[model samples]
Structure formats: structure tokens, C-alpha cells
Target: MDVRISVIIPIYNVERYIRECLQSVARQSFSAYEVLMVDDGSTDQSGRIAQEYADRYSRFRLIHKENGGLSSARNAGLEQAKGMYVCFVDADDYITEDYLCRLYEKAEETNADMVIADYREVEEQGNIIVKELGQPPRQGCMDRRQLLQALTSVGECHYATTVVVAWNKLIRREIMCRHFFPEGRLHEDEYVIMPLLLECGHVEWIEEVVYLYRQRQGSIMQSAETAMRHLEVLQTYQNRIALCRQLQEPELLQAFKRAYFWNIEIWYYLMRTRYGVESSRLYGVFSRRMWGALLRYHHVFGRRKTMEYVIFAISPEYYLNQYFK
Candidate 1:
């Protein structure tokens, strides 16, 4: 193979972290891999920094384009990728030295369409370790249905974090290029991950922790609850539910509905309280939309879950002062 893997790193105002991120790619034990450092019109020195790496190393490829979001940058990288397998690394996050080597090895060994692994989350300051996330993809190759089950937490204990997230998986390039990232979307992964899983025949799981995800203070994940991004998440989950129906997986449908109920419950709680008060217009629209959705999908909840949602949805103030206090 000319290139076995193409590792994509989408850049945007990540000058602070881009060097570490690129250095990690450069240090990977895997030899037959290329790094597509797609700079999304970063005003900072990020593109220049990446350009320096591309200038120094043969494997590092710098792609500079106008200001588009992360998805657009990733899309550009994918379009120009010439590898059999593709994996994504966020501009702010980097991987372990043997990350690509191990993942690629598993893909070839198991003849898997996708290979999933574990990751670590560390706070930005002090390089202090916050915790390790060992969300299992289950050891061994999984069929489409099995992967779906693992992803949605249908019969499992909880949802696997690796399922919805774009990173932490080595996907076949053919399948990746077929499903382009949605341009200008907040939670871009939500639109693609499950569908890609459904298209795959086998997904290999391994215990090795290959990625180090940095937890920054002002990241979108942190502000999701308070900002309009909460709306994006709900929309994404609803899309998942619809995908389940399209697949005719009643089991998955029921499971996702249960998940959806809790998501709504939490969003409702947030909106009816302090965090949601910032944007009154958005809050009002979100409240009405969720209220309607709650009534429509009410049957998806069991008696207990319904009660749980109603308790918070009906009276967040009481719950906050009493139950939460």
C-alpha cells in the first residue's frame, strides 16, 4: 500500500496546542502513515506552525483553507487522503506514540472495518490526570447490530463514549469518504458515526489506550448545557432514534428512546434554572420544542423514567432546592 493510514488533524485557533498535537503524530511508531493537518483559516500561528512541520517531515502534509468549522477542515483532509484507513485527531488533542501502530495492527489482524480503543482525559493545566475512559467496544470483532447495541447502550450498562465520538477509531477510507462530514454543524459526529457503523461488517476492539484528550476550560463540551449547543445535541439524538427506525431495529429504537428521555429531562432541568437563563429567546424556543417532544415521545419512557423526567421537567426549582440540595 502506498499509504496504509491517513491521520487527520483539523486546525482552527489551536496554536497553543497544535505543536504538541503534530509532534505526537510525528512520533507515532507506525511508519506508513501520513498526517493531514488541515488548517481552517486559523488567525493564529497554527497554520504556520503546521507548515513548518510539513516542511520538515515528508509524512506531514499541510492544507490551508478559508475559515470553515472543524467538520469542513476534516472533510478537506479526507478529500485529499490517499490511505487505506483514516483516523481523526482533534487539533487540541494528540495521541500516544504507538496509537496508530496498535490500531492499524488490530485492523489488519482482525480484518475489521473499524478498530476502536480506549483514551485518557487530562486537565490542560499541570498536565494533571483527571481520569481514564475505558469505554469498551467489547473485545473482538462485532457485527453491525452488535456495534449498534454497544453504541446505544441498548442492553449494556451505559453508552460507549467511543461510539458517538469521531476520534478513537480507525475507519476504512472507502467508507469514510462515502460519508462526508456535515458542514457548519456543532456536533458533527452525531450525523455520521452510527451510519458508518451500520455499514461496517466488523469492528475490532482493543484495550490499549491510544489517545490523550485534553479537557480545556472553554471547550464546547463544557458549555453545551448552557449554550444553544444543547439544542444541537437533542437534534442529534433524535436523528439517532430516526436512524434506529430506518434500520428496523426495534430493540435499538426502544433503547434510544430511553436515552432520549433522560437527555430531555436534563435539558429541561438546565433550561428551567440558572444556566439556561442567559439567552432568553433561545431558552423559550428550546423549552417549547422540548415540551412538545416530551409529550410525543412520552411512551418511550417507562413509568419510573417518566416520573423521573416529570419531576424535573415540571419543577426544576423544587428539585434543585430539595432533591439536588
Candidate 2:
């Protein structure tokens, strides 16, 4: 029996959470799907648990390899996937039993290349907060251009980062195959998602909550060191800019700017925590470069609302406190 969807899970040291994650998939109402668990060299008992699940269920398959980071694990799963559609689920996260069924129904109805569903954020202590970033359109069909415009204009729809979690949506396998994620990057999703969205002609939005994203304290986004690694995030934005230019999609330019500004604020916060006032010196250099980019893409902002330009105009430290603190 051919599977309609391949659920790819990249497992690392998630022994504590792996059981719940796998069980959620196992109990899915959508039966015609295979769970592909790629163990990325876990030092914990996660691998053993994965193997146990694989042995119990024919649809579950396990692949063990040396840890090459998240991107490598996802790529390995992508290469081995055999389904019409593919959706990624982080090993530590769990989905509603009807997740695949709901996403698949939306995709089939709209004939959409992608279908995105809402998800809940679960804190370490098991507190759950449902996040609905924006209201979905009533009835059917979302125009790709209009969606992009709304997202960019409101600074909401920008892809990249975990905001566009690979797992919360179902994507056509063919489309995913056309664009492979860049490995060897700490923030691979930021580098990959925009291109995927650009290539997708139609996207379906569903209001139902399908996945639960666990927010652990020690996650990369929460760490001081990872937050200080702002250069990598900036590089992702640069790549997006180059790609947008090459494709001649000028409308996306504002989205890129919004993302860059957001990164600047985050970096400033990290610097404040790590180096205090001394951090301003390093930020001074970054501010100059950002100013240049803002000027080059002046059309993205108006004269009156160019607060970023004004703040960054003075000095990095000035903008740092103004935007971040």
C-alpha cells in the first residue's frame, strides 16, 4: 500500500519526549502515512525507543547515523521519503491525532502545493498556549501574491526561522524535491523556507491546531551563546535578498528588511546580556552596515516612518537601546 504522506522526525537526545511524539503519530486518524524517524546520533535512550517503535509497527522506520546537525537529519529523511506529500515533525514535539487528516483534506480541496495549520506552544511545565498569529481567510483559496503582501505589509507572513516550522504544514513532495535545504548552517530553515514559498503556486490555510511545539528552557533560541550568533541569522537574510533580486520579486524586499530589523533587535538583547555596555562597540559596526542596506532599499520605508534609519543613523548603541531594550 502506497503512503499518501511521509512524516519525517529528526531524533536527537529526546528520550524523555520521543515516546509522546511517536505515540501521537501512531494514533493518528489518518492511517495512510509512514513515520520516518532519523536518529541523528543520540547519546541518550532515544535511539532505543525509536527502534522499539519501528519493531512494533510496520509503517515506522528508523535510520541511525552520526550527528550532522538538524539539517543533515532532515535531508537524510527527505532522500529516503516515499510519499506523495512530506511533513517534518521535530522529535520533541507532538501533533494532534487528526493532524495529517486535516492537513491532507485541506490540500486536496484546494489542490494547494502547501497547507499550513495552527499549532500550540507547550511550556516545559506542560502549560499550553495556543498561538494564532493571524486569522485565516473564510472559505477557500488564498492568492499567493495577496498572502505575501499581507504578510510583508503587516510584518507577519515572513518565512524563515521556526515561525515557519517545517512540521506544522504538509508540503507536496515534488515541490520539496525541487528545493533542498542547505546543510552545515545553524539556521537552515531561514535559508530554505522563502524559496519554497516562492516556488509554491497555491497555499491553503487552516484554522485548526494540529501540532504542539514544546518550548524547552535549553533550546537554541533561548541560549545566550546561540542568540549571540547573530551573524548566521544575518547571512540568511542576505541569501534571501540575493534570491529575491535574482527572481525579480521586488515586493519581498520589505519582508527581508523586517526580518533583518528583527534580528538586529535580538542581537542587541543578546549583547546586552552578555557584554553589557561594552557590546555597543561591536554593534556600532553592524549598525553602519544595516544603515547602508536600508539606504540601498529606501523604497521599503517612507521618509516619516524611517525610524530605523534615524536610530541606526546615530550609532549602534543608540539603536540597540531604542529597538532592543
Candidate 3:
């Protein structure tokens, strides 16, 4: 039987959550899908757990490789995908039982290369919150330009936001095969999403929550190291701007600038609050490069000129205290 979708899960040290994730996949109402669990050299029993699932289900397969981080694992899964559509699921997160069915239906109905769905953020401490639902104007025949405009205006419609999550969408396998995910990067989604959207041509937005993202205290996003990773994120966005400029996609370039500056503002706040004035090795380099990048992409600053001025004037500590508090 031909597979309709390939669900790729990159497993690391997620033993506690892997079972729930696999169980969710097993319960998926969409039967014409294969579950590929790529174990990225987990030191724990995560690999063993994945193997157990493979043994239990004929549709589940396990791929083991040396630890190469999240991007590498995803690329490995993409290389092995053999379905019309591909979807990513973090080992620690689970999806709705009808997730694949709904996303695939949307893709077929619209003849879209991708279908994105709304998702809820499961906070580590607080209650789960649903992000606002976006209703795409057209049910079918959504054009690339309209999709890009919708994504940029409403935020990254590719579901790259932690709030939106990459896992909540189903994309045509060819779209991913054509544009590989950049490996060895902390913010690979930031690097991959825009390019994929540009190449895919059309995307459908389904206003249903389909994935459950579990927020844990030990997750990288919540760790103290997140501040350090923010520096890498800034570099990724800078590269993204260069790529957009080379492609001569003016709208994408403007959108990248807006997202890039906002990220810088957040990073500066994080560094001040979490790392304080302690100068790390990358601190000086990051600060200088960030300012340079902002100036290079000066057009984006026109709308938020006051915000940029405030960012330049105040100490990071003050901004952190005022906003994050």
C-alpha cells in the first residue's frame, strides 16, 4: 500500500515522553502513514523505546545515528521519507488523533504543497494556551504570493514559531526534498521555514489545534543556555536576510527584518536578566554584529524607530526587568 504521509520524529533523551508520542501516532485516525523515529544517539533509553515501537508496529521504523543535533536528525528522516506528505513531531510532543487526517484533507482539498494548523502551548508551569486561529481567505487555490503575505503579516505562517510549532503542519515531501534543512544550527526552523514556503508556492491554514507541545523545565528553550543560543539565532536571521536579498523577495526581506529585530530585542533582554553584565566570549562579538545587521537592514527600523531608540538607550537589565517581570 502506498503511504500518504510520513511522520518523522527525532528522538533524543525523551524516554519519559516518547511513549506518549508514539501512542499518539498509533492512535492517529489516518492509517496511510508511516512513522519514522530517528534516534539521534540518545545516551538514555530513548533509542530502546523507539526500537520497541518499531517491533510492535509494522508501520513504525527506527533509524539510529551518531548524535548530530536536531537538524541533522530531521535531515536524516527527510532523506528516508517515502510518502506524498511529510510531518515533523518532536519526541516530547504528541499530536491529535485526527491530526494527519485533517492536515492531509486540507492539502488535498486546496491542492496545496503544505497545510498548517493552529496549536496550543503547554506551559511548564501554567495552563495550556491556544494561539489565535487564523482563517485563510480561500479554501482552495491559495496562491504563493497570498500565502507568503498571510504568513509574514500574521507572523511565520509556516508554523515555525514555538507557539505555532513545526509539528502541527503537513508538507509535501517534494517541497522538503527540494530544500534541505540547514544542519548544525540551533534555530534551524528560522533558516528552513521561509525558503520552504517560497518554494512550495501554496499553503493552507487549518484553524484547528493538532499538536500538544509539552513544555518542560529541562527543555532547551527554558534552559539558562537559551541566552547563549540566542546569539546563534541572531546570526541565523542575519544569514536569512542575505538569502532573501539574493532571492530579491522584497516582502520576505522586510518580514525577515521585522522578525530579526524583535528577536534581537528579546535576546538582549534575556542576556541581561539571565547572564547579567558578565561578559561572555561571544558577548562583544554578538553585540557588535547585531547592531551592524540592524543597520544593514535599515528599512525595517522605520516602523519601529522608537523601539530601536529605546533598545539603544536603556541598559539590558532595565528592559529585562520591565518586560520579563
In order, the Cα lDDT scores of the candidates are 0.77, 0.75, 0.73
* TM-score per candidate, chains pooled: 0.86, 0.85, 0.81
Candidate 1 structure lDDT: 0.77
Question: How many clashes in each structure?
Answer: 0, 0, 0
lDDT of 3 by residue, 182-256 (tens): 787676775676677777777777666677778787444444455466567666666666767776778777887
- Root-mean-square deviation per candidate: 3.4, 3.4, 4.0
TM-score of 2: 0.85
TM-score between model 3 and native = 0.81
Candidate 1 collision pairs: none
Evaluate candidate 2 by giving its C-alpha RMSD to the native, one decimal: 3.4
Top lDDT: which candidate number?
1
Identify the runs in model 2 with alpha carbons over 4 angstroms from their true place. 130-139, 150-163, 220-225, 246-255, 258-263, 270-281, 302-314, 322-325
Q: Rank the candidates by lDDT, best first.
A: 1, 2, 3
* Model 3, CA-based lDDT: 0.73
Pick by TM-score: which candidate is best?
1
lDDT by residue (tens digit), candidate 1, 57-115: 99898998999888999999999999999999998888889999999999999888899
The alpha-carbon lDDT assigned to residue 321 of candidate 3 equals 53
